[model samples]
Target chain A: MSNLFFVDKISTENIQSIENEEAHHAIKVLRLSVGELVYVSDGHGKWISGPISEISKKSLAIRIENTGETHAEKPELVVVQAFTKSDRNKEMLELVTVSGADRIIPWSSQRSISKWQSDSREKWMITVKEACKQSKRFRVPIVNNQMSTNEILNEVKTGFAIVFHESAKEKFSEISLPANLDRIYLIVGPEGGITEEELQLFSTINATVVRLGAPILRSAHAGFAAMSALQTKIGRW
Target chain B: MSNLFFVDKISTENIQSIENEEAHHAIKVLRLSVGELVYVSDGHGKWISGPISEISKKSLAIRIENTGETHAEKPELVVVQAFTKSDRNKEMLELVTVSGADRIIPWSSQRSISKWQSDSREKWMITVKEACKQSKRFRVPIVNNQMSTNEILNEVKTGFAIVFHESAKEKFSEISLPANLDRIYLIVGPEGGITEEELQLFSTINATVVRLGAPILRSAHAGFAAMSALQTKIGRW
Candidate 1:
């Protein structure tokens, strides 16, 4: 199937016009003509199927014939990633989006190299949105603003919580999968790794300390690794 | 601990001299003095601890005091990755090294983008060595020259062989851990993914087909995910 674009609105009855950037992309880049079928998702669970009705240099029109619900329901997996440098954080965000994480919480730990500003949060959201589109995800993963360790612990819902640290004794496969749980929270530390106080806080909250393997992966790699392993173990993969 | 370098040889009795690029780096960049201690690994599992004996612009010398073995006696995990474009292949190689794979083999698949040449093999080995140094690994992962998929499959030793494919019914965690097997062969396909015939061939040879998750990950990302999961499951993490 061809890719679907997220648009503001589509006229379901007769002819729908795509203007500005979308129109330019369809007419100039893709060179779509009349009667060409395409799909458009509004990024809100509604997907519209249509064919090109009119094509122009500045605008293109398509008639929406039918609509379908695009809902991908999986066990919610929240990735709590400690703030890394800009490039590493971007790669981590893309991985999390493609890995089907339900939510992403940027965390501020003692060894974090990058700090989030109020203005940059919206820009980061755009990156997540693009990743979601590329990965064919119907709904975008929620990117939350920076939060402290205590704030994350307090906000965690009733589910299986795991903190991946190198010092942990239990491997991820050894942990018992929790029954009757719809969410899983995974916490990954910064480059220098989680501090003693952070580990103690997670322990106090009864979070399982899970270790991946012998080699020490970077902070970004560890997040994806943990998510993949946990999802496979829970049969959600 | 400071970063360690891999050298060709270490003498037991007299002062060991570092020449060429390494000497320049030690003398000019780090500005290490005569009494400072430094570490060196021979890349053959020998780690040497010594103090600087002499320092100069062209050469620096170190007197070896003690030597020890730093090899991990755990199971060997080999990652066979299909060749992609240069940038993506480099990223995959770095991930394999960082993820603690013992060896990395570049194989030509039906949809491989880049063709491997004999002259470029040395350059690829350098990339693997650099990745090993950056990841703080004493033993550098071996980078084999490019070969065909059938050639690789034929060379697989007695171990738990698995291929990560999206069409696989069983999740990687479903495979039972083998007790006496010390080698695990992980085969990761290209961007277009493994062909149906390749999957059937692997099945005919008793190689287990394993799936990572529901979301479609890029080829490089899939290799890291599989390696991380298998490492954790086998108690090597």
Candidate 2:
């Protein structure tokens, strides 16, 4: 696989020049020579692949050989992840992104131990973007601003949502997704686990409370497991 | 959930004393006091949960209020993981353990960059045990010594095996597991990817070549994804 770099914009021109941070990464970090081939993605849907034409201190030109666009998946997979401690948050982002989550919402659930910072979204984007590059995803997952429990209740009303709890009586295998569903939200709680009151709140909105299995997974791990199961159930895997 | 500690032996005795390394961890690291409830497992199948009856400087005793045993899963889930760099190996161990891998075998595939150190198994066991405690799994996963390609070939002959490859045409969703299969091996390659020779060797043994989806997953994350999907398909989740 060719090394992929993110760019702000990708065009159909014969020759494209990459500069600034991404180019610096390619030239300095990756040490790509003038003739080496590489990939560039807009991190939405458009991408180009070709050999480097010229190398400079701050920029490199690529002779575009292939250009293509990947259409976003219908019924996008979204994750409403509760904030964990600083150490585990980045791991959660990488796991969910690699599992093909289309969007991610940082949730401030009742049992969450970490308070969302102003730069949390920015920090999360860096990890998500790196995961996208590692996973070869052209579409970078959107990380929404931190949402409160009430906001999550309102958000679940718009799409099919499943809240994973260890104590839930319902098994995820028994779920039957609607045929015309446009999006699905997978909610994971914090390390402290979900509170009873919050479960009641999601219950009132008819969001299904489902359990994965017997093993007690950490907050950083449950999202990846849920995403993988959902993707397999939806025939994406 | 109560914090769980691993002991070499757990008995039906009403009062059981936990000493040594596990006790030190409980008494010092976790700071448990008398009457504090916790669980103790033998790391095989038997476990007991109860309030602390006595707390000394180096040992803690449990009242053993509840005793239970977790039977090993039918069709045990095993991962044949190729050696990766040191940093990613620990992450891979944690992911697979939390995702409910029953056993793990280190493999030295053709493209593996890291050589198996003499103490690799011991180090891996420490990580796997920590994950088991975090995941609340009574039956801790067993980490086998590093095996060569020929050994892996001979091992796969006894049970079903699935090799995850990006270029494979067959999707994981298309595969059907055997009804009476005793064990299933999920093979994951290294960061450099699996060589054609290894794929061909596995294919010769009738191992199924399956792809998860379009997105390229890193070696550290693929085992967890495959395990989750497999667990769901087999109705374990």
Candidate 3:
């Protein structure tokens, strides 16, 4: 796997310098000597790769040999993940990020045992970015502000959404998904599960309630399972 | 969700006692009280559910109200996972177990960074059992002894298998899967990836090489992604 560093922008210049923490990571941690190949991404769609030209105290310069842009796939896959306990935060983010979630919404459901911390967003951003580099994904997922159940319902009203429940009669494979929609939302609840009133509210908007199978996945694992199934169903995988 | 404890066997007797470690877990860790509804499974489909009748220092008694058996789903979903580093052992097992893997095979691929420990099987079994309890799965996944590349080749020759590779031209959703298979083997390589010789070796046995998507998944996560896609593709999810 290629070691990828993030930059604010990627230009078409023949030469560039990588500074700050990423430079330290490249020089000290990864131990990349001069003339070693490396990749740099803007964490959107643009990326450039080249050989290291110089190693300096403050930064490392690279000679650009290739540049490309990754076109975002259509019918984005968005995951509305409820806050899990602190121990599972990294696991949850890694699973969804590698499973190709285009967007993520932090949800605070009625049954959620964990409350969002003051630095929750910052911590989540760091984890998501690391996952992007590991998965070789140039298009980083957009993480939104925490949402309440009512806010989630309002968001689902304008788009197609599927809520995974253990008691749902319909399986995810048995449901019909729209082909023309710009995005599909996958909703997962907390460890204690979703509330009955919240289910009724989602039903009012005609959002589909479905089960993945017999196994009851954790709140963290459910989003990844749904995304994988949806991506394959829509012929993306 | 009801707390589930594993027993060697679930009898038709009106009352049964849960002793040893399971009893400790319920009485101490979970702090389950008398008259609380709980479930006990034989770990091979047979299960009983009832309310606790009494709690003792060495045992807890439950009055059986209902007993049932889960028929094994046809065309078992088996994961052939290459050994991952120690840090990822729990994450790897949890993902596959929650994703509905019927069996798990440990593979020692050429590029595997971690060597199988003497007590690896015992540790894996413990983790898998805990995952089963959390996922509400009655039939526990079978964990086999570590197998070499040649042994895995022999196993693949006798069953239908799909090897997940990043450079494969075929997407998982684009392939034609047989409907009558008794089992489908999903093979995942190590973090460093499968070697060219091993790919050829699997190819000789007519194993299908497929890619999940553009994103490169970690070895710990690929099995879960493949299992989720396969389960939904076959209408099991």
- Highest DockQ: give the candidate number: 3
Better of 1 and 3 by lDDT: 3
Cα lDDT of all candidates, in order?
Answer: 0.77, 0.91, 0.90
- In candidate 1, list every pair of residues with a backbone clash: A213-B237, A214-B237
- Candidate 1 lDDT by residue in tens digits, A131-224: 7666666667788888987788886646678899988988777888667677789999998899999899888889999887655678877788
- iRMSD values, candidates in order: 2.0, 0.9, 0.6
What DockQ does every candidate get? Answer: 0.47, 0.75, 0.87
lDDT of 3 by residue, B4-88 (tens): 9998878678987798999999999999999999999999998899999999997899999988888898888889999988798
Model 3: residues with Cα > 4 Å off, grouped in runs: none
Write the residue-wise lDDT of candidate 2 on A1-237 in tens digits: 688888888966888789999998998998899889888889998899999999988999999999988889889899999999889998999999989899999999888998998998999999999988888888899999999999999987899999999999878887899997988999999999999999999999999999998889889989999999998898889
Error of 2 at B173 (Å): 1.3
State TM-scores per candidate: 0.84, 0.97, 0.97
Reference-based TM-score, model 2: 0.97
| Candidates 1 and 2 compared by DockQ, better number | 2
- Give stretches of model 1 more than 4 Å off: A7-39, A42-75, A157-159, B9-20, B29-39, B48-75, B157-159, B177-179
Worst 10 residues of 3 chain B by lDDT: B8-17
lDDT by residue (tens digit), candidate 3, A53-140? 9999879888999988988887878899988887888989988998999999999999888888788888998999999989888889
Error of 2 at B3 (Å): 1.5
